[model samples]
Target: MKKFLVLGVLFILPIVAYLFFASGVNNFAKLPVLTPAISDVTNFKSLSEENVSLEGKITVLSIYGDNVEGREGNAFNLNEKIYDKNYNFKDFQLVVIAQDGQQEQVKSLLNELSSTIDIKKWKFVFGSKEEIIKFYKSLDTNLKLDKHLSTSHAFIIDKNKSLRGRQENNNEEVRYGYDTSSVADLTNAMVDDVKVILAEYRLALKKYNKKEGLK
Candidate 1:
């Protein structure tokens, strides 16, 4: 009787252990999400003035070719796509990381965003490396940055303000007959990259806000 009872206990224990472990085999992924690191945004005037860090707003940062005003027209159009056309502006944000010396250009861009009719709840940030690294350090270390990651390509940051995608730069500049295009035709493609980030941001916002009881 004793031997038979021991065998039964051993058989059931292994089965239960196997089932429990198998059910959560993929849970390690949850640990990688970590938390936001926006505290490092040092160069902005508003961080002290507004007493804010855009802690709750999603950010779309343009790390590219010109100052904010240089790209204001393009940004205005995108605003319509997100706010009016798509109605996805509840948590969307916009930032432009222009060249370090271009404050005047950035200010013009901000004015453009502010003047737009539907510019509600959106935040526009344009600043230096100190202010921007917070956006970068917030991302997964494995995520790649575009080699052309200057002040030209737009980077989409999640509500947590973690950068997810941006314009990629291919160092290889080639000539299509006489056009002289630097980077491959497939390198640093911005639109597709931003879309991928937006999808993930949508998922994160849904989960985070739901947990926080936000609508």
Candidate 2:
């Protein structure tokens, strides 16, 4: 009777272990801890004069110059998608970096966009052109900035200020392309990337709370 009971216990233990892993709980708990050394370079203030940081938010960053005025096709479209999908604006934000003198024009443009959607989560940050250029290079992106600060690319800055974007093993560009020709695909991919980043943050929060309770 004792041998039979021991055999039954061993069989049940393996099955329980398999089920636990199959449920994906194990994978979720083991999510990699992102520790990028990059610090937030957003020294500019928003239209409302609030300093920005990535301590508790995911950011989509773009540098807008004089050329950014009438040629913001991709930026405007991306904004609409983000606004429509992100019901909780606190979790996601869009940061538009412009030169110090461009604030009034940028604000006016943003106000026009606000007519269609809530622009509360949209932040227009202003700094010197030289200062902003240095900040843009720090992201390590591949997009070439022409006279207009025009580039088909934007970047994802995670809560930890670590840059997050898809990069093929041998691809030159670290970020997902923003070509207007493939606008649909690019937009969907970007939005999906943002969702994944947010999910990672939520999982990290849960793990932190669990550890705190144990202590």
Model 1 misplaced regions, further than 4 Å: 1-43, 52-54, 64-66, 80-88, 98-104, 126-150, 166-215
Q: Spell out the clash pairs found in candidate 1.
A: 63-151, 63-152, 63-153, 64-151, 64-152, 64-153, 65-152, 168-188
Per-residue lDDT tens digits for candidate 2, residues 1-215, read 99999999999999998887645543543222233535564577677878776556777766676555754676667766655577474578877777777767886788778877777777777777787777766666556776866455666777677676766547444453344324675566766666666666666677899999999
Identify the runs in model 2 with alpha carbons over 4 angstroms from their true place.
1-35, 39-42, 87-89, 169-173, 176-182, 213-215
Per-residue error for 155 in candidate 2, Å, reads 0.5
Could you give candidate 1's per-residue lDDT for residues 1-215 as a string of tens digits? 99989998998999999767644433321212233453434345431134334456555544433334445545655554433333354655554444455666655555666675555444434456544555555543433334333432344445564444322238532211110021231133433344444555565666798989954
In lDDT terms, how accurate is model 2?
Answer: 0.66
lDDT over C-alpha atoms for residue 150 of model 2: 49
Q: How close is candidate 1 to the true structure, as a TM-score?
A: 0.44
RMSD after CA superposition, every candidate: 12.8, 6.6
lDDT of 2 at 4: 94
lDDT, candidates in the order shown: 0.45, 0.66
Error of 1 at 148 (Å): 12
Best by the TM-score measure: 2
